[model samples]
Each structure stands twice: as structure tokens, then as C-alpha cells.
Target: MLLRLPTSVSEARECLAEGAVPIGGATLLWAEWQRDGFPALAMSLRGVPEAGVLGRDALGAAVVLHRIDDRVPDVLRLAAASVGTGAVRRTATVGGNLVGSTLRCLLPAALVLEARASVLGPDGVRETDLSEVTAKRPLLLGLRWREPVASAYRKLSAAPGGRPPLTVSVALHADTAGPRRLRVAVRDGYEVIDGGAPHDGDPDTALHTLRQTALRDLPEAAWDAVAAQVAVVLRAADDV
Candidate 1:
């Protein structure tokens, strides 16, 4: 297999234009390698300095999951920590988590965070909403977001430490002169609730909103559970 270690976005773009498959941590490639052998050419994003950046409001695409739990918001940190085993977490990249189906524990958090992707393609780097970028395997430079006032995450699995079927991320952003804005994102099919925080007395309204917006095979019980979790997060944010 041919390997390309690009130290800059320009070089990464050139590699991509030449059909080199992007590799960050390469956790997703292992299975493909086992099934179909290695690709002819691969570009490692790890060597790119910009892709390795982490800050209060941004994380580079190649940022490793293991190191982010302490540095990120609670919702993103929890999602990152729950992704895989310690070894996997240490190797997995934020960009990889965004694109790989098997490693999408961070997707819901991305939605709630209102993260924007800095995509590097043949046309050069451009910013796009993390949830709206539809092109397959677009090269990611980094992700940026506005830090919310408070955030919470909950994952429900069939067994302890097992893969969770459902993950919920909720964030509360305080409006300068109005009510706090609430964002709820479910891992299932990008279900989201983006609006004013539900009133304390009207819990059922939130449930109805989730039901109206959720566009997947989400069970009734699952909606109830998600609504309850969102309510919990809102209440906690209120206290803070």
C-alpha cells in the first residue's frame, strides 16, 4: 500500500484529488483491509498540523477521541468517551467519527453543538454545517462551534458498556435578552428539536415536538426516554 503523510491542507487536497483515500486513525479501514485488502493509496491526516488542533470552540479533524473528554463540553466529551475501548478511543479521530458509520457516537453532539465543518475538497476548504454536508467522504479540516451555556448527554444501551442503540445530546444556549434556546439531537436519524426551552409545566409539548420531528423507526418508548432526558438537561441548565 502506498502511504502519503501530508503536513498541510494543500498537500492533503492534492492527495485527495489524486484519489488517495483519507486516513485518520484508520479505525474504519481495518475492517475493509481485512475484507478487500489495502487500498493502492492512502493519505494520513495525522501529520497535518491543522487537523490535530483542539481549542475551546474548535477541534481539528484528526483530534484523537481519548484526549477530548477533559477539553470539550460535557455532551461532546461524554459522546467521545463512549465511542469505543480505550485503545480505539486513543486512535480514533474526530473527523473519522463524523464520517464513519461505525464511529458516529459524536453525530448527535455535533448537531446540538451546531458544529460547522471546514471541508477540504478539490475546490478548496469551505465551511458547511456538520449536519448539512452531504457529499460522501469530503475531506474535513476541522469543526467549530459556539459554546453553549450548558450541555448534557445520555446513552441507553441494552447492557453495561455495550453499544448503545440510542444516544441523546441536549444543549441550552442563553439568548441575550430572551428565553434560553434549547437544542436536542438524537443519534437515531438526526432527530432534532431546535427551539425555545419547553416550559416547566408543559413536558408533553416537548414530547410532541420530538414525535413530530423524529423521522425514523424510533419507538414510542424511545421518544419518552429522550424527552425525559431533555427535560432533565433543561432543568439542570436552569439551575446553572
Candidate 2:
């Protein structure tokens, strides 16, 4: 097996240009590799910087879960908390959590936060939306985004204790004059954009509409319960 460790972002990008499959944390990737013989070329991203919670929080993808808990916003914190246990978090990286996408709890939170990520490939370093990266990837060097006024993440597990979570996240953009940006990201990425707040035009109307627009496909029996839970997510943000 060919292995490369690039410490800097530029070096990481160079490795990708050569067709190396980038490995972030590899909590899952490594497992797959072990199961199906290792790949020809594997680039380890651990050498890059991926921790910090100040200013936009540089959050290098290599930073572990414990650091994520220390620096990221509440929504991200909650998502990180749900990843595994303290031991797992100590080894898990944000990029790893993100790659899990629906398999983990952080993707929805990252979307709700409208986080921005830097993907490096042969072309160059380009800034892309969080949701956009969810569908594609090359290498995630860093993630940056401003902290929201208030944000929350929720999960509906398949059972009492489960590894994968049916996750949902809500983020409120605090702007008094302009239309509110109420970002919500479900497990499969049901997103609701800008809308009036409970006070602006109608009380809970936007929230209710969000529930409808995002959860319209649910069966009649589960609709109300899901909506109620979504309401709790919205209310939780407002209560903060």
C-alpha cells in the first residue's frame, strides 16, 4: 500500500492531484479498507491543522472530536457529543464526522450552521457550501463559519441506543430588519430557507411552514409527532 502524509494544505492538494484518495480520521474509511484490501495510494490528513474555536474557528479537518467540543458552536457541539463516547471523540475528526454524512450527526448541523469548507483538488483551493460538499468531495482542509445567534440539533434514534441517528438541526440568523434566515437540515438534508419569524408577520407561522415544507412526506400518523419535535427544535433556539 502506498501511504503519504502531507502536513500543509498545499501539500495535501498536491497529493490529491496525483490521484491519491484522501483519508480524514479514517474511522470509517480505514474500516472499509481493512475489509476490502487497502487501496494503492492513501493520503493521510492528520498532519494538517484542524482545531480552534475562535474567530471563524479554523477547525482543520484533522482536529479530533474533543477539540470540536471545545471550539465549535452549540449545534456542532451537540452533534459532536452524539458521535460516540469520550474515547471515540478523542480520536474522531470533524472531517470524519462530516464524511459520515447521513451516517453521523454532524452533517445536518454543519448545514444548519451554513458552514463553509475549503476543498483542495488539482484545480486549486475553492470555497464551497457545506451542503454542496456533502454530495461530493476531494479533500476537506478546513471549515469556517460565523457563530449563529442560537442553534440546536436533535436526533430520533431507531432504538433506545443506536449508532446512527435520525438527526435534525435548526439555526437562526439574527437579523432584525431583513427577512429571517431560518436554516433547518434534516438527516437526509431537508432544508428550509429565509422566512419570517414568529414575531415579524405571524407567530410560529414560519416555523409551522418550515415543518410542512421539510416534513411533508411523513405518514399521517408520524406527521404530528415529527412536527412537534421540530417545534421543540425551533423553540429550543428561541428559548436560548
Candidate 3:
């Protein structure tokens, strides 16, 4: 595998056009290469000048890039927390998570945070919602989003030596305008719950509603008792 580090999005796009897969941390690609030995032309953004800073655009909205400082609101902080351990977190670029769809792999939280990708593709730089970007082929440069009214992420895992999280979920409070605003995301193929009738009673109830939705969506045979346990923790956290 060859590595090319481009400093700018235009340069990265040119590289991608030439058949290079733009890489940030190369976490998933490296894992695949180690396991399967797949042949791929790799372009890493490690040495790229702007690969690590999280700065806002001209409009001064919160922009959460890997290279930037990490002093944002709950949404960005939670997303940053999903990027593996301390070392991996520091080196792993936001672009990597966006491109690899690892953001989807982490689940529930990203969706609830209302994350969106700022993509640089064949046409040029464009903004896209996270759900749409995950479904397409655009190269992800970074993620941006305003803080949610209320949001939380929870994961369920087995014993210490057991498997990783079997399920993950993110829930966010949306405006009363439409169903378009209410959002939930889950991993492990769990069923989803969409909470209608915005209630200001407690964020915990909202989260529980989403968890119940996921539980209801689970396949009869695949339902895990631990999911309910995690939901309990989320509910408790909401109370605090």
C-alpha cells in the first residue's frame, strides 16, 4: 500500500480521483489489510497540515475536526469520545471516522447528536447529513453540528473478557415542528423507536421511549436482556 498525504481538500480530491482512498487514521483499512491482505492504494492525511485542527468556518459555527481543539458542546465531545482510546483518539482524524462510516459503527449517539458531514467530492465541497453521507460514496472531510436540546449515548457489553458492545443507541430531543427533527440511531441492527409528542417532563423518559422502541424492534430470538440494563443506566444518568 502506498501513502499520500495531501494538505488540502482539493489535493485530497485530486488524489481520490486518481484512485487513491483517502485515509485519516486508517484504523479500519489497517485492520482489514491485516486480516485479509486486500490490495489498496492508501493515501494518509497524517502529515497534512490541516488534518488535526477543529476550527469553525467563517460563520463561526461549531466545527469538530480531528485537528481542532476539543472544547465543544455535548454532541462533538461525545463523538470525539467514540474514537477509541487516548492514543487512537489523538491521531484519529474526524475525516477518518466520517469516511470509514465508523461513526455509524459507534451508533445511537452520532445519530442522536444530529451530526453531518462536510464532504469534498468530485463536484466540490458540500454539506450532507450524516445519514445520507453514510449511505453514499462521498469522501468525508469532517463533521459539524449544533448542540442538541437533549442527547445521550449508551452501549451494552458483556463481561470484561467478553465481546464488545452488543448494542448501542443515541437519542436526541428535536423541535416540535416535525418528525424530521426527532431522531434515533442504533447499532447491532436493533429496532428503532421514534418519540413523538415532544414532552418537557424529563429527558430520561425520552431516552427510555427510544430504548423501548429499540427493544420492540429487536428480533424475537436476538433480543438481549442486557439492552434493558443499559437503558436503565441511561435513564438514571438523565436524572443526574
Q: Which is the leading candidate under TM-score?
A: 1
Runs in model 3 deviating more than 4 A are 34-41, 46-70, 75-87, 101-105, 160-163, 166-183, 189-197, 202-215, 218-240
Residues 1-240 of candidate 3: C-alpha lDDT, one tens digit per residue? 777777677787788788886666565577878898855676765554434445332111112234343344443455456555777766555555554644344334455555566667788778877656656746665555665554444455547654444444334354557432334454553333322323345545544564466345655433343234334434543665
Root-mean-square deviation of every model: 3.2, 3.9, 5.9
TM-score of 2: 0.78
Question: TM per model?
Answer: 0.84, 0.78, 0.63
Model 1, 208-227: lDDT tens per residue? Answer: 65455543347666667667
Q: Candidate 3: worst 10 consecutive residues by lDDT?
A: 56-65
Ranking by TM-score: 1, 2, 3
The CA lDDT of each predicted structure is 0.76, 0.64, 0.51
Q: Which of the predicted structures, 2 or 3, would earn the higher lDDT when compared with the native? A: 2
lDDT of 2 by residue, 128-170 (tens): 8875666775467668876776676666656655434456666
Q: List the residue pairs that clash in candidate 2.
A: 50-60
lDDT of 3 at 44: 63
lDDT of 2 at 56: 37
lDDT of 2 at 108: 67
- Runs off by more than 4 Å, candidate 1: 132-135, 159-164, 189-208, 215-217
Order the numbered candidates by lDDT, best leading. 1, 2, 3
Greater lDDT among 1 and 2 belongs to 1
- Model 2 residue runs over 4 Å out of place are 50-58, 100-102, 160-164, 188-203, 219-240
The worst-scoring run of ten residues by lDDT in candidate 1 lies at: 192-201
Global lDDT for candidate 1? Answer: 0.76
